[model samples]
Target chain A: MTDPRLTPLAASLPDTVPFVGPETQQRRMGREFTARLGANESVFGPSPRAIEAMQAAARDVWMYGDPEAHELRHAVAAHHGIAPEHIRVGEGIDGLLGLLVRLTVAQGDWVVTSEGGYPTFDYHVTGFGGRIEQVPYESDRVDTKGLIERAGWTGAKLVYIANPDNPMGGLQGARAIHEMIEALPQGALLVLDEAYAEFAPEAERPEIDPTDERVIRLRSFSKAHGLAGARVGYAIGPAPLIAAFDRVRNHFGLGRISQAGAHAALADRDHLAHVVSQVAAARARIAAIAHDNGLAPLPSSTNFVAIDCGGDGAFARRVMTGLGARGVFVRMPGVAPLDRCIRVTAGREADLDTFAAALPEALEEARAAP
Target chain B: MTDPRLTPLAASLPDTVPFVGPETQQRRMGREFTARLGANESVFGPSPRAIEAMQAAARDVWMYGDPEAHELRHAVAAHHGIAPEHIRVGEGIDGLLGLLVRLTVAQGDWVVTSEGGYPTFDYHVTGFGGRIEQVPYESDRVDTKGLIERAGWTGAKLVYIANPDNPMGGLQGARAIHEMIEALPQGALLVLDEAYAEFAPEAERPEIDPTDERVIRLRSFSKAHGLAGARVGYAIGPAPLIAAFDRVRNHFGLGRISQAGAHAALADRDHLAHVVSQVAAARARIAAIAHDNGLAPLPSSTNFVAIDCGGDGAFARRVMTGLGARGVFVRMPGVAPLDRCIRVTAGREADLDTFAAALPEALEEARAAP
Candidate 1:
């Protein structure tokens, strides 16, 4: 019998994964890393209360999670000072992005983003057969102006921007973002991903109208809340667009434990304040380590610091490899220019101590490489 | 500014949720379900070892789960006597079904299923713009022959069948399933969802070639393993097709706790066997209850028994509503002939005591209704 026929779009796509986890790297290397600082995960972990809630939720694993994710949605809505109708929760921002792409992007539709912005967003756009128009980052930040101009030219349906951007950890001020939204072409929607909003200063996060049809804000419990492994994220937008997600989403996608954990995490404001302070200290430590190693540390409004290796992409790659060999796990930007820097997440004192101890040797090894 | 423009297909689709979860109903009613037998979940709950594993994993929630889901995938592969490459773990069977539909069904593509088969599968198919061709059930079981015939005539790309069927609890034995697979039209793929496989006799499950390109077998941790709230499901198929999922699936979709729990659950064979025996006893008790109430319980190979109320679709719906009002949550088939029955899940002794106490009154109320 003939093999099953894939859709033309599916057939044309190549098999790939957006981000490889540290676990896979550890398995390949046959040992665990001494410092697990990769992927911008909050090593400080979730609140003790959140852990207790998840543990309690473990006993009720027999029932499917509430399909509507009612309690968690309301909690998130309250936290954002928005009505519950303005919020939609999904497996994560990644899952929600996929659904949004499906809803708005038809084959050959145009979408716009920065050259080395979140690869997962680009992956979703391409998966839905949308053509991407990438504009290079201006300075270390995402070029909002470039993005808006490209969207205008391409007549793109969707435009994506991540505040306090990944890899470089650079922020665009609230006013810059408001201008970007105002400049959006007719029928074009801005996808403002604020995954690290909790880590940024309040003024750096735009205060958008909840009913604004031009933009949708994405947030994650992964970073500041320390619930990355829980797979909880939410979107806030116009009621109609938020409600539209119900039509195409896996209604029962969220796990009961995840919902309980996230809800508890949101309720613990002291823990969030503690995490933000701890992350600030860690980021400072990372920056100091970069300076001591004779490297340049970029300004960061997020949990990670990007350290310029004082060399090109290949030299930086060798430094990253050397760090990995020294049992410190870290990542770098994929595209050039940004690739000159190795992105390091803020970790606990012990974890960063491992990174600090390894930096000099890794830099020496990279400098000595042919 | 104009609102975002949805793709033509998305704009044409209606906003709907596949199933109204019991939690949603409970919230609407402003009370908790007394029996909780509606969704066919294993009230016996997951293995204690699995619960411990999950609770332990919760502490590490700061880290994203292994994108490859290595340990759990390998465990699942070993259980089925197949290579790890043949398995693809997803959020749940529902999530996997959506991905499968995306892979095979393009706009206007044809898919075939029983008229009242799992509605979530149909939701996924239609969400991707595929046209559905439905064949009526034969007796209470999914009509495999009729599905094959329909596929041949419509040149359908995908055909879905659930063994030990939902809503009716009917089964097609191994030989019949093998015949159905053999008769699949060229280029047509069979999506065999065996979510309740652990509850069925071994002889009833088909033994197929792992490399068979014609079919993809789905299994869930939800039903007999009692991890429905954990949202773990897997697909076993040809290596190429299984690997293809990596291209489109959320790479880090599975949660760390879920992976750990499923891995622990798979290792505890005694727990699985105990749950199976418990489900069997509960099903028998439900059948006995139906007989005492002068209703006929269909022969079941699943965790639930479908009892004929000796009435039409509307009457069965009324009976379900009556059960809901009486604090016993149960469901019924959505199509005719089969709709004459209300499906009740196997539950603990106390839970079923509530069901037994409520059934006669519910039936009387349904019969008394206009």
Candidate 2:
């Protein structure tokens, strides 16, 4: 029998998704992998203070989270030198992205993202029935001009770009992105997803004037903060726009313990800096391993490195599959030239050594695969 | 300059929301209230085991939560005797509600709900641009036939009913809801929100099979489970429907500590039973208090009591304000009729005494206020 409650629009949408969790794949494969490098999650862990806060609050999980996310928002606002009115904390950037899509895009509305940018953002745009238009990455960087020109051409309402961009681990200077933000078509919003911002060179963070409308920068605790498991992300924008989240968000939806943990995490700026250093160190180590294996590791400003596989997408797929078969988890880009690379997250020393050992063997196996 | 990014449909939608959180009110009031009984959160809290599990796992916040929520889903499926594929976990019922709206409703899509059922559900539908068509409750029970008729009349793609419903705390037996579901419009989906199900009589729960594609059931940790701060909720339905969540949901969105806590909470059936019993006792005590105060408390199956103020919405508003002013943070219904009653959540004895002491005075003050 057909589902009777689905609207025509829901019915019309396809059931395909962008990424499947490694857990699902594990279930399918009936075994867990050894080196977990696939999803770009930090294996280094969160601050002791954040962890302690969550643990302490866990017993009190009986209370609903502070709906206003009061203390966390204040801490975040104070940290950024902006008023709390300028911030809205969410489940994650992914959650915020979905909410932003719902708030700003309607069915048949045009939303733009780079062809090989974050797939989750594109998923949100399409999920809300927004028609997606894309700009391919140029020289391993997201072409902000091309995105703006397309936005103007399609009259798109939203555009997504990850600074310290993902997969390729490229960077765009603050001045250029800020200039692009200013040039964005009137009425359109710039969604700067800075999931990897903590790792971005200091100069790469676009100097966002708090009063600037038409742009909302998304930040996450998942990367350098090492709280990926907490699912904390916030969007920074003009007050009126930030307030719109209240109009549509899951208000009492935050986890109380998670909120306390995030608040403490944000307060302990020292922890964040330490994690940042660890990430930089991991990146350097990962680059060395890729070079030793004769694969070219792209310059990265993020936690993960994408190693050019020296062949086509199919060859890269073979390499990824070979590693998986040997119990190492890694991911690859979705499209051509980009797909000729495999994305590996920075992990602990043991994990890195596993990846190091697996690479040459996997590459040889892929080269020999029929 | 305009927000060139927001869609025409988004531009048409208002930025104002129906619910302004109590925290925001607290901030506006410039002081914290002594008793926070406004939001119907369980103040007693979750099981110690659940708390312990979450706290213990807190330090591992660097690893992303299992995107599939594998362990948690399996636990829920086992608890309900359903296949793991039949359950979909999300941020919260509010978050699940948002996803369900997107899954079923589109702009101009017909959606049916009780006039003042759950405002959050309606909020989600409206956010997704669905046109809400409300039917009045009969004798405070959601007029099942009225909803079915409205669904058929408007060809509503989705219909929502909360058993042991919010605001009113009214209930309908499985047989009644089953019949309604049977006669529901072809292809019209039934959304049974059982947030308060643990407090509900077992007999009142619908015996519908989990694999039934025509319906979806939602349960929350925010209620009796007392993990409201954790933001864990699940939607149970057929494999195809559950699979649909993967098509759009943020895979790694659920937080690590939350996932661990919810899994533990689900496993501790004894704790759940204890909570259910305590809530029942509290509900009885709350009802008795309403009677002692010369108000008619609606018989409830949930954790809160709705005490009829023997007047109109304005009188109930006074009672709420009186309670608020005197440090008893009770709330009243939003719309008319139901607004004739003040809603009070079950709290500790001291909190109840505070309510008892504050009521008449608040009432007197309301009577004297211009």
Candidate 3:
């Protein structure tokens, strides 16, 4: 007989990766992608100051990172104008989301999110045995009222909404988000993922209180700070919930160099401002490229543009595959309606130039496909 | 009314940090520890090649790490003479332990471990709501037979054992470990944590097949490889179980820089060999220092020595506090009997010299304490 082995929940789970990285695809293709923009990672790169801090910390790999993430948390708290107790730094928002799921979702519990939203959050919900109730987006934006309605009906414990949502690069304004937060059912909590907050206009960003028990906001260095490879993110929430993270988190999960890099990245406001403007410029260029190719570009407040491929999901998939074949890496949404578009990250001039060159050929190949 | 909340299990858990890192202590003391020997981290540091690789990767932080960790996993698999499918790498052994506990230990499930073994493993067990049945250490080593007996009686889903264990530095031979594996109950899997495997004599390390379903062996670059700050560790086990990690692991948990550093560190075998020998020499020096101070140094196969203060747990704690006050960071076991000793990590000559100089004064103060 086989071993008594995994718990039933673990046994039921399929060995699935929510997303395949561009590197894996590159390996299988036996070639490097000339334009790398698949995963919504920052292409402007971390500040020179941040890179230098990481390099300086590289020789100190013997000691484990501070478990409390003291200095980094303090820096983040100061940046957000919150107490250090309000912040909990983690490996990344990906890691933090898993912990949040563990803390709230139990077996057979209900969690709510927009359809075709972040698959990583869904993976965590399922991994924790939580049932995910999907609400279809309203005009390409996460349907806030629909999400609240579903949560109330299903008694969902957690409701996830990514401001400047992935795949579509759509955003909801502060007033809409504030209403959503206030509308949450008594036992429900709003997980506001602000991973792209730095790229959004100030007026569009929410102004929720850090101590609001009804909400917890997650931010990442992976987006604007250009430190995705550094694996640093932080959650700002009520002290009680943030305190709970200590009971379950891999306390030493953040690397010492990552902590150092993050601290420096936070301090370099000029670099962040520069990256934001560059992302805006690149976004405009991407939209222009889409318009030139006879595709429609959705309005974006993020570092990426979602271009409607003017056909079915299959057409979009074909375009993405065509891009892959042409040495340009890009991604698209998985579900219907949203799948009519391909998402491209803001990249450097050279990287965008490569994408610009490859786009016409890729579109031609897609159009020529049976 | 309060927000819809964490699950009852999550709410019921206490906010606890298993180990308070020396960095936190240093911050509290408003000064850095002179020797920095508390965490059992290697003072010899990661290989020069690893530092170079990490520094090189700093500029490339925009990319998220490969979700599969292909190159690093392949390198580790090759080094161990196993197929890549047999290995799963994560943030560290701590992160992997959290994943393993999540996989096997559902609420109210039974798990077994030595009373004073790795606290991080115990933290994971409780975090997952597993009922931990601790078998006391026998004569300063993990009670292997006791653990097996407890597992059988409780129908434990998992049993944990650390070879060349932390805090105590006591080890069991390869034959004994193999026997323990064979004796595991039908419903139980042994989590053989070999975090210190590189430091032990080759004959003392077990020779279990990589395909063994009954056991999962964990190894860490954080230990002898001097990459603790990098947060890289891997598990070697049956392909089925190794595959299950995909369901719950933060797919992009490991940093791109960390993966690069780990690959370079693994390739530098000469650096690893040199660190191992240096750890051994440091262990000998620490033991000699303990003897000179009229304390008993437990024989060690790991990178740290456990010094018996020739008194009770309280006495040992005072000595540890005295050392801490003197800016010589060190740690002691949390439980009784075993707590009679203070754990000191092996450090470079200058670091140990700092410890050697601080020991006598600290001992005198501890001895004079009421």
Tell me the whole-model lDDT of each prediction, alpha carbons only.
0.91, 0.83, 0.91
- CA shift at B136, candidate 3, in angstroms? 1.3
lDDT of 2 by residue, B230-269 (tens): 8899999877777777656777778888899899888888
The backbone clash count of each candidate, in order, is 0, 18, 2
Ten-residue stretch with the least lDDT total in model 2 chain A: A1-10
lDDT of candidate 3 at residue B60, scale 0 to 100? 91
Ranking by lDDT: 1, 3, 2
Model 1, which residues run further than 4 Å from truth?
A1-4, B1-4
TM-score of each: 0.99, 0.95, 0.99
**Model 2 lDDT tens row, A1-370:** 3354555655655666677778777888899889889988877777798888888888767777777788898889999999998999988888888888877887788988898888888887777778999899887778999999999999888888888888888888888898888799987888898899988888668888876887899998887777888888999998877877776777776677878888888888787787778878888998998889888999888889999989999999999998888788999988877999999998888988898888899999998988
Model 2: lDDT of residue A138: 87
Q: Chain A alone, model 1, TM-score?
A: 0.98
* Per-residue lDDT over B94-161 for candidate 3, one digit per residue giving the tens place of the 0 to 100 score: 99999999888888999999998899999999998999999998899888999999999999999999
TM-score between model 2 and native? 0.95
| Backbone clashes in model 3, listed as residue pairs | A187-B4, A188-B4
Per-model DockQ:
0.70, 0.61, 0.71
TM-score of chain B of 3: 0.98
Q: Kindly list the per-residue Cα lDDT of model 1 for residues A87-205, writing each as its tens digit.
A: 99998888889999989999999999999889999999989999999999888789889999999999999999988788789999999999998889998999998899899998667
Best by DockQ: 3
